[model samples]
Target: MILWFLGLMVVGLYLSFIMMRRSLKRSALIIVFGIGVVGSLLLITLNDNAHFGMVKRTTTNEQTIYTASPNVQMPMLLKQPAGTADKHAVYIYKTDPKKKAVHTKADLAVRNEISRTADTTASLTSQTTRWEYQNGFYGALFNHEGAGQFVSQRNQLAIPKDWFILTTTQAKRLSAKLKVLQHPTAQQKAALATKVKAKAAELVKAEPELATDQTTLMKQAQKAVQQQLIQQAVQDVQQHK
Candidate 1:
């Protein structure tokens, strides 16, 4: 859109020179010159506020959320920053269980929202506001300068019930306490290991394909064992109190 204004301004200058050489003999040049000046100012005004030559479009994308046990359908760990509680922050998650975590794009013009879903799928819906030419004439005139320029964008993410949202600050502070709660004595470890193996067998029996996948089965079993240990720790603490 700015290019349209600048091009008109340049044409207006060229017309001024032609009018000077012709010494006002070509009266038709006056109308052409007037058009050039008016068109330039009109484009400038439109680009400034009205944004007549542009449109906003939206798109959506859905991806699988990584879990502790992919085959067994374990809870997902969604990491966020401390600042996220007050304002929008970057989200880090993995698309696959074995893949590295991916961070969302952080920018001033970018906004983010989150919604909860009943199932386990994660989705990101992006609404981008860019300067798209309304017609072929505007497309040609403003094609070279800032064509398809980004105005703003908004991302809406759908959260699932299986997601365990954790803030970085909270995770750091609770690191030691969580270790204490999850840790077990030698005897406890022996017993917990037996329970975990039994749990793995039970889950595999329910989903037969996990019998060959050691990693997912082990993760699921370990997670269940850790949760039980944490609950036992809390009970012991209450009893002592």
Candidate 2:
């Protein structure tokens, strides 16, 4: 995209220079060239500013499963479980900021209700901080002084300053879905693997140029399917909830 923009600018400048040379009046040529240069420079500046602004926004919007203050220690449970140690281990999706703005009223009401309920539960005395969702995974961000003690006893897990503990039912559902995601049925895996291999073989046979990268292409396809399955699992949990 950047290359295309630069190419256009170069072509525009060349045309402008040609027009300046052919002009009858020197003052008119100077005025036109100056305006064109100024306009182009302004556009380039705005384009750069916009690009950087987007990069800044994207950086700030990056999501993580866990984050901790300097004084806090991260919990072990938040770590990826042994088997599901790939990109699909923890699905993280960013919500559209515009959609978030649109639903602010209803979301606020729900949040207030949860806050009130948490206030009443003595066991949940810890201050109820805001909840955040990345993809379908939900967790509350709270502050607790005795977070370490909670983790040691296994009474309640602490995730940095906030903890994400699932109810028995939620845990069961999450586990079941994750199992399907991490380890698809033998038949499912076999079918997809065979299809990918066959497609790659055909492509390589037709265009021998792609033969060298056949293995890489096949792995990418398999990885894509795995990611799709993981997303589906997340969606299932969200819908059921």
Candidate 3:
């Protein structure tokens, strides 16, 4: 419908330009230029490379690069951990009326558990899913207690086949380990610290306000609480370890 409307508008505009061209000598160039600009805008609107707001922006070297949105471009199933294919079912369940788009991160654990328990169920087979607005959970049910299975179309990425379950202390230890891995010896650590400090100084030179407190320590503490709930993934090798 939108395409048809845009097409009609373009046709009308072109005809008007043609009439103007006849009235004004050598105005053919103006009409052609106007058509080209309009055509380009229409093409961009019809096939947006940004994938309809699914793309996210990541920054590097003062430039932004857009990456496709996982849920919009890729099948929902591809996001699942491997081998959990049999255990997890992805679906668009009925959303609660009171809460709009309130599928909190905590719900992911519940969804995982549900899939694990209902693995034997006939409907809980696939991992990839594409529940259109008409077929999604909210569309199916007006209230909250609605849920369904999600399946994958294909494996998206090669993730480690096993799981790594990290305790709070273990995660903290790994964070320290990551720092040490960057510098095996005290001498190397000192050198890296100096290099990092220099880089930080350069960044502050470019963006002087970065040195100021944009977020308070309390906000950092709150974020730490949320981070504690997440577990580091284990790879295929770690499964047998």
Candidate 4:
């Protein structure tokens, strides 16, 4: 591509100069002038798009999960879709407790995926591919014209097993359900106690190590019960499923 661009400009100028000196016909001048114009147009197009003289680079980043529960007891992982449909996705999270929630980019250049992990801490690793001039020569030509620009990025989130993933729409359902569950009625309290006991037993059977520590066992059980409730809410609210 570079060779072609340079060749057109150099050859066109050489031919035009020779023709002018020899007093060539008007048609000869027009052909060489057209060559130069074509070459100039190509340069303008490449410089505008910043498509040439770029390299793809990958980078990774990690962020700790933020839990809004009072005791770090209920770990909630939230996600929001770009639109009513579930095609383009983005995550809502907070890397710091003090800062406001952060939403991942919803631009066409960005993509996201999630996976489960056994660790209690959640993290996000991103591979960003952007355009960067190959060297100073290309940079000098296209620096202010967007030499280095965002192309695309893929984010992979590895979340803890204990963390419950809920969409924003489902979260609203969860909030309403919690208000009802927190009622002072005796029946609701009894049912919650039963669910916690059942979830604890199920978890212990799956991983027997949790039974060794009574405090950790109960915490895990509490988290499990809440997660179960959220899962039910997700089912109730997901119309696009």
- Model 1 TM-score relative to the real fold: 0.58
For 3-98, candidate 2 gives per-residue lDDT tens digits of: 344456556656666755665564565556566566656644644443211211111111222221111121112222222333212211112322
Evaluated with lDDT, which candidate comes out highest? 4
Off by over 4 Å in 1: 1-24, 27-31, 67-79, 82-85, 107-111, 151-154, 173-178, 185-225, 228-241
TM-scores of the candidates in the order shown: 0.58, 0.28, 0.21, 0.67
Whichever of 2 and 4 has more lDDT, that candidate is: 4
| Every candidate's CA RMSD | 8.1, 27.5, 23.8, 6.5
Off by over 4 Å in 4: 1-38, 67-71, 189-241
Q: Is candidate 1 or candidate 3 better by lDDT?
A: 1
Residue lDDT tens for model 4, 1-241? 4445556666666677665565556457656667776766777687666466667666667667575433256577777777766677778877787877787788878988889988878888888877776788876654445644788888888888867677777667766776665563888678888988888898889989889987888898887787677667656665532
lDDT of 3: 0.35
Please give the clash total of every predicted structure, in order.
0, 0, 17, 0
- The digit string of per-residue lDDT tens for model 1 on 100-165 reads 667666666877777788966776666777776677776665553455677787777777865545
Instruction: For candidate 1, give the lDDT.
Output: 0.64
What TM-score does candidate 3 get on C-alpha atoms?
A: 0.21
- The lDDT values for all models are 0.64, 0.38, 0.35, 0.71
In candidate 1, list every pair of residues with a backbone clash.
none
Q: Over the stretch 1-241, how does candidate 3's per-residue lDDT look in tens digits?
A: 3344445656666666665545554365556656655765664453343222122222212111111112222111112232333354332211332332211122233333222122211122223343222334333232211122222232112112222323223334544544455445888557645655555565556667656743443344333332332222222212321
- How far residue 83's Cα lies from its native spot in candidate 2, in Å, is 34
